[model samples]
Target: MDDGDVLTSAGVAAGLDLALHVIRRDHGSEVANAAARRCVMPPWREGGQAQYIDRPLPDEAGGGTAATREYMLANLDAPLDLAALAEHAKMSIRTFTRRFREETGQSPAKWLTGQRVRHARHLLETTDLGVEEVARRAGFGTAVSLRQRLHAAVGVAPLAYRRTFRAADHVRAAAAEEKA
Candidate 1:
C-alpha cells in the first residue's frame, strides 16, 4: 500500500502495485499504464495486498474486463449498473457478472462502490469542494448517499474525514517549515 511517504507491500505482486502506484503518482497514469502494458499487468488494482490473492489473471488471448474497468474508472460519476457494465464488457449480464467476480473476487456493484468511495475520499482530502458536490462527482448522486457510503467505509462523515486529513497536512507542513 502506498500510504503517503511510506510505501509497503506484503508480497511480490503487491510490490509491483506499489511500484506502479509510485509511477502513477509521479509520472501520470498514461506512463504507468504503458509500463503496465509492457509488463503485461493491470494498470492499477485498487485495494490492498489481500485483494490480490487467488484472483485469476486476464486470459492469454486478452478476454478480460480490464478495458471495462478502465472505462468505469474514467466515468465514475456515470450510472454504471450491471446492465451498462455488461454492455461495456460485450458479454451477457450473467456472464459479465460471473467473469468479473472470478477475475476480481468482487461483484461489479461492490467494486464500483469501493471505487466511488475511494474517489470521494480523494476529493475530500485534496479539494475544497462542498460535500454535496463531492458526493455528486463521486457518483453517490446525493449527500445522504455519500454520507452513508463514506461513513460505512471510514467510520466518519465526509467533513470529518476532510478535517482530519487537512489537519494532518497542516501539521506536516508546519513541521517541514520548522525544519527548513
Candidate 2:
C-alpha cells in the first residue's frame, strides 16, 4: 500500500528487512552486512524474499559443525566431499549430514557451492583476472562451469558481474596507474 512518503511493513520480520534496507541505502552493503553479522543475523535478505524458512537457524540449537565450517571456508578450492567433511568433523556421514543441515539450513555441498560463488564474486569484483583464472581460484575448475554457476546464482556473466561490482577504489587506483 501507498502512504504519502511513509513506509510500512507487514510484521516484525519485515521491519528488520526495512531497517536493513535503510541501513544499506545510507551506509552501503558492507556496513549493513557487518551490522547484521554483529547481531548474528544472516547477510542482506531482500524485502520480497520469503520471510521464513523451515530449516533451523544458527542461533537455534545445533552443534559440532562450527569447526568444520571454518575448515571448509579456508579450503574452498579443495575437492571436498561428504566423506572428507565428515572425517574432518570426526562424525560418520549420516551424523555429519544431519548436523550440517541443522546448523546451516542447507546441505554441506550447497553451502560449499554458495561459499565458492561468494568467493568468485569477490575475486571478480576486486581483481582484473580473466574468467578462467577466477574460476580456478574459486574452485569452479573451468570457465564454462563458472559461467553456468555464476549465471544461475546472479543472472549475470562473470565479466558483467565484475563490471557491476567493481570497487570504486580499484577504479581510482587503475586511473592513477594509467597516469603514472
Candidate 3:
C-alpha cells in the first residue's frame, strides 16, 4: 500500500509494482526500467492509479485510447476537453469516451483529473515549485483548485503533502548515512 515506510500489495502484479516502486524510490527510474526489462514487465505502471483500475493497461499498438492518453499526459496544462481528446484519438466523441471507459474503467475527465493529481503529487515530492505553479502545470488552473483536488485525493493539502514527503526523504537520507 506504500504508507511511508510500510509497503504492501494485494496481488502478484501489485507485488511487482510495489517492488518496482521501491526500486524507483531508492535507485531512480532508469534502474527500475532496467529491472522491469529483466523481468519482462511493463517499464512502469503508476502505483496509485493501477490499484483502482478494473482492467489492465491498454495495448497501445493494438488500438485504443492509449495514444490519446499519452497526448493528454503530455499536455496536462492544455485545455483538453472531450472534443480535443476525440480528435487526437481519431474517433467520434461518443466512441472515444466509450473506449476510454472500457480501457481505463473511468471516464476521460476522471482519468485526466487523476493523472493531474498524480503529477501534482510527484511535483510536490520532487520539486520546490510553488503551489500555484504546480497547480498550473497540473492543469488545475489555480492553487485553490489544486488544494481541493489534492485534499480530495490524498486527504491532505499540497504543502502538507510536500512536508510529509520531505520528512520521509530526510528520514531515508539519515538512515542511509547511518548505514554508511
Give the candidate number with the greatest TM-score.
3
Weakest 10 consecutive residues of candidate 3 by summed lDDT? 48-57
Clash count, candidate 2: 0
- Of candidate 1, the 10-residue stretch with the lowest lDDT total is 48-57
Name the Cα RMSD for model 2. Answer: 11.0
What is candidate 3's lDDT per residue for 1-180, written digit by digit as tens?
779978888888988988999999999999999999999999777654423223234566755789899899899988899998899899999999999998888999999998899889889989999999999999999999999998888778899889977998889999999999
> Which RMSD values do the candidates have, in order?
14.9, 11.0, 13.0
* Deviation (Å) of 120 in candidate 3: 0.1
C-alpha lDDT of candidate 2 relative to the true structure:
0.80
The regions of model 1 sitting more than 4 angstroms off are 1-63, 173-180
Give the per-residue lDDT digits (tens) of candidate 2, residues 72-143. Answer: 888877788999999999999999999999888889999888878888988987788999999998889999
Strongest candidate by lDDT: 3
Instruction: Give model 1's TM-score versus the native structure.
Output: 0.62
**TM-score, each model?**
0.62, 0.62, 0.64
What does candidate 1 score in Cα RMSD to the true structure? 14.9
For model 2, the superposed segments whose C-alpha errors exceed 4 Å read 1-62, 167-180
